[model samples]
Target: MLRRIDEALINRANQSLLNELEADYAALGDKLARQNIDIEAITRSAADFQIAVPSWGTGTGGTRFARFPGTGEPRNIFEKLEDCAVINELSGCTDSVSPHFPWDKVDDFSELKQTADEYGIKWVSVNSNTFQDQPGQEHSYKYGSLSNTSKEARELAIQHNLDCIGYGQQLGAKSLTVWVGDGSNHPGQQHFQRAFERYLASMEQIYKGLPDDWEMHIEHKMFEPAFYSTIIQDWGSNILAAMQLGPKCKSLVDLGHHAPNTNIEMIVSRLIQFKKLGGFHFNDSKYGDDDLDSGSLHPYQQFLIFNELVDAEYRKEQDFNPAYMLDQSHNVTDPAESLINSAIEVQRSFVKALLVNREALYGYQEDNDALMASLELKNAFNLDVSPILAMARYRKGAAINPLAVYRSSGYRSKMAELRPRDPNATGSGIV
Candidate 1:
């Protein structure tokens, strides 16, 4: 194993903040007591929360046109896991990684598993990259992949996904996430029903290939690379495909993949009701799939999503387990620092959502008291839960102020020397 952030450095950094942290935590506890909330309970929930980091996100991301590479971006999957380990060390909430294949593919799957084991990291969903084609490719995905008009292209896509499942099994992943950029660019360019039919047929084969213990997650995107329409365009189509495939197949929601002003929480509720909600690709977006940091643009929206999630937990809803992973594309900031901040922001949402008085909210809803119902949600969203989040990290042997400790450790600067940048950024390059 490589040298991690020094324990002494973290201890020193945390010691400076411990006094203030305790004071704030006590004040918050006192405030919550009147509302019948337990600060310790909220802190424990936060400490127990674990969001997986996307391996691709460990590198600097760019817009559709340009990429501004950072000094020490991970050159391969192993290097990416190294950076992911550092993020978990500081944040303490990201114990697993969601890896994308063809991008993260290697000859030795056993070595990858051993490397992750040494770092105490687990694998979440293994993502398939049918959106872009790889080198020496026999088939081009320019028109489409799984839903391509040509049978050969569709078969190639299906095989790639099956191959991803094979790779994931060795890495200890229980799920496969499929997001295809297959759609029509022009209105008359393609027939909608026929295209969807083709997609379902291709997916059926991939579904059949899944191990009995594994699941297949279908991710939908509104638009990008193809503007007119996408096969799995929204939740409606996502669930439809899931239903057609079988029980183990379900929809994976990406926060940035929806149309503007769409009521995502309602969609999440709908998915939960029918027992088809699979997982999430957590990120914030101002426009379309901007891949901004989590909870950056709209913390309230993030909290609202969590509110529904916590409600499901409160109700003891069966089959409610949804894997959470950060899916931002960091362009300017250090990827590790951005990941640390994103994890805390997400944890902040979860912590605050737990503060909601479920009984009060339910009563207000039952009575149809609009104002009180609104206030019930607003009240929980408005509170600052920083102390609880910090306390959780402190108790987990993580940094009290994760970002501060990360900067103090100088991990990035050191990595710049160890993993020098490639002249040509190969994987997911400039697109």
Candidate 2:
């Protein structure tokens, strides 16, 4: 009887979604017809956009000051997978999960792989933790990890990355993401050149250990943990390190990793031009690395980034594919709901970017009409594509109103009942 109610609710929601899609396509089709573009092709491509959810994002996220864990938060990787499944089932966008090592480590990885498979989740990228000290560790990364002046500390960091690659291999993951808190906090605290050299030396060993088909993702942060400087502090540093390391190495752009008002889209364009763009750690920030959900603070900026990406696909034909994974930490909002919403917001930007009339924009550029070209981009952005997103999810057997569905299903309450909170327990990773 309860199953029937669930089915009925889903069916009604899907039908409404289809109606909305029809209306949107009809409207957007008129705009596309001006350029003689095929609307169906746009929808088809939009349907194919998929992003990966971070395992750590499934739990409550906090700042260095304090963390407030939510009810039914996933206590382990298995629990995290269950939460990730809910996001995918609703959004129809996040089909993969990126796991952070040690934080998400599991015994019997084969079992872990099988469990994830059961939930229709695939591993995206495996992130290694070398920023903090581990239990029973011989050395501390208090000052640094790969860039540590201590040879033992550097070696420890290198071994951890290698182990992560091995674990990724078992899960059929083809990438390892490495980010380090290796920098000096005070002026004249350390030698920058020597530190980076040590980091490179440490990275060489990890890069060599990667399987031939695998890629190494180097994430750069402008600051945090290190007040004065970070080893891989910006795109220039990231790309330079990638170039020095070899072909399989690429730069990862975490949206929150840059300084405020940075031209991230330009950086993305440059990276793609160099064919060294590895992937993304999607998030938003008002100031430094806030780790807010993607598209929350700057939807337009997100749209612009997608504009460059879609432009690359349409014009450059670069055979370059950047992995998309969310790296956000939400202190408020239910993690599952936040993830689902973030995924949709990203998809919204994608759909808007797809609507850009490329041929017209090109013509405008050729004619040296900068204003009109900018207008061409804005025209698409102005059009609301909620209906189109609704349509795509409905077609894919996902929820039209994912949040509503989740609430109606009482999944969170059920999770709380089944998995109870641990008041005495604490967790690792970003606050």
Candidate 3:
């Protein structure tokens, strides 16, 4: 039997680090006091921060070239939940999961929900799959799904979204995310206005089907499979579609989905100002949509994005709550380890954002002190809040050093022994 990482193991691990943690935490706390910042409040906020894990993220992800499958790749949604449970148990902040449709679709949603409940997980945004065709589908999404010129294809895509809503209702999810690769490859191949019109028509049906409390998130990518143009190619189109759909719809931001060096934080700010920001699919990239782990290459970018988020919170922006979830594609390293690390990095960013003196930042903005304003942000970002993060985990009964303890658990080796690998498994890689 595969033994899960239990309290005994965590206690043993924490023993060696407790004293060091206390010393570091106290020193940081005293330093924060000098600046009139309450470290305890930040620790509480850190302990309270939550990000939903993508169920498919538990398995090995790939690049456009190839996928080097890991030793214990999850064979199905059941196994994926097991891995997700382990991640949440150790990481402390990721207690919910964002599941993709068709890939995670099971015969019995009741059993699936029960299984997730047993694992202490709630469902978040339910992701729909019209981007790719499933086995024995009536209409092919080869050219497009929502914006397909074929009425049959558009109806099929719309029905699938309604089914996704049904599935989410059963699992208690409050949101649905839709991202379609519906565009052309050659110049003048598609009627831009006509394609968008068709997409809006399809999305209108799905939006009408939403539960009163549910929000429909439309995610946009600069370019992909369709290089010339995509239907909802940027935030402008995304928000336009959302507005046309209704108040239940909004635009979702994926960090890696923009052009290189795009000012994503400004986009986030705009969405927030209009109450059209649905949520986020958190991931980092060096180029475009590399799907690198969060904070891997651009920690400051993540921090800046969070700076906007924290500012919204400080100002009590109405209807400003946004869902946070990690959407990385881990091509290398253990998926679970990468998730824990990313969760910590995200948590670290939020905590550091909290350290930013909002009042001072506001004053700097008002006075046009660009240098001091940049310095204020840099000062907060430069602070190492590791102690606060560790203390939060320790207080919440999570591992002080989650990745270290996860390594000690050997969970992957045990899983590899229990489940045989599938040689023909494929993934949603960039190709």
lDDT of 1 by residue, 305-410 (tens): 9999999999999998998999999988999999999998998899888988999999999999999998998999999988999899999888998888888888
In model 1, where do residues sit more than 4 Å from their true spots? Answer: 1-3, 426-429
Model 1 local distance difference test score? 0.92
Which residue pairs collide in model 2, if any? Answer: 62-431
- Candidate 3 structure quality by residue, lDDT tens digits, 154-182: 99999999999999999999999999988
Error of 1 at 408 (Å): 1.1
- Per-candidate Cα RMSD to the true structure, in Å, reads 1.4, 2.4, 1.6
Candidate 3 ranges beyond 4 A from true positions: 1-3, 426-430
**Candidate number achieving the greatest lDDT relative to the actual structure:** 1
CA lDDT of every candidate: 0.92, 0.87, 0.91
Return the candidate ranking by lDDT, descending: 1, 3, 2
Better of 2 and 3 by TM-score: 3
| Model 2 lDDT per residue over 344-390, tens place | 99999999998887888999999999999999988888887886777
Model 3 is weakest, by summed lDDT over 10 consecutive residues, at 422-431
> Regarding lDDT, does 1 or 2 come out ahead?
1
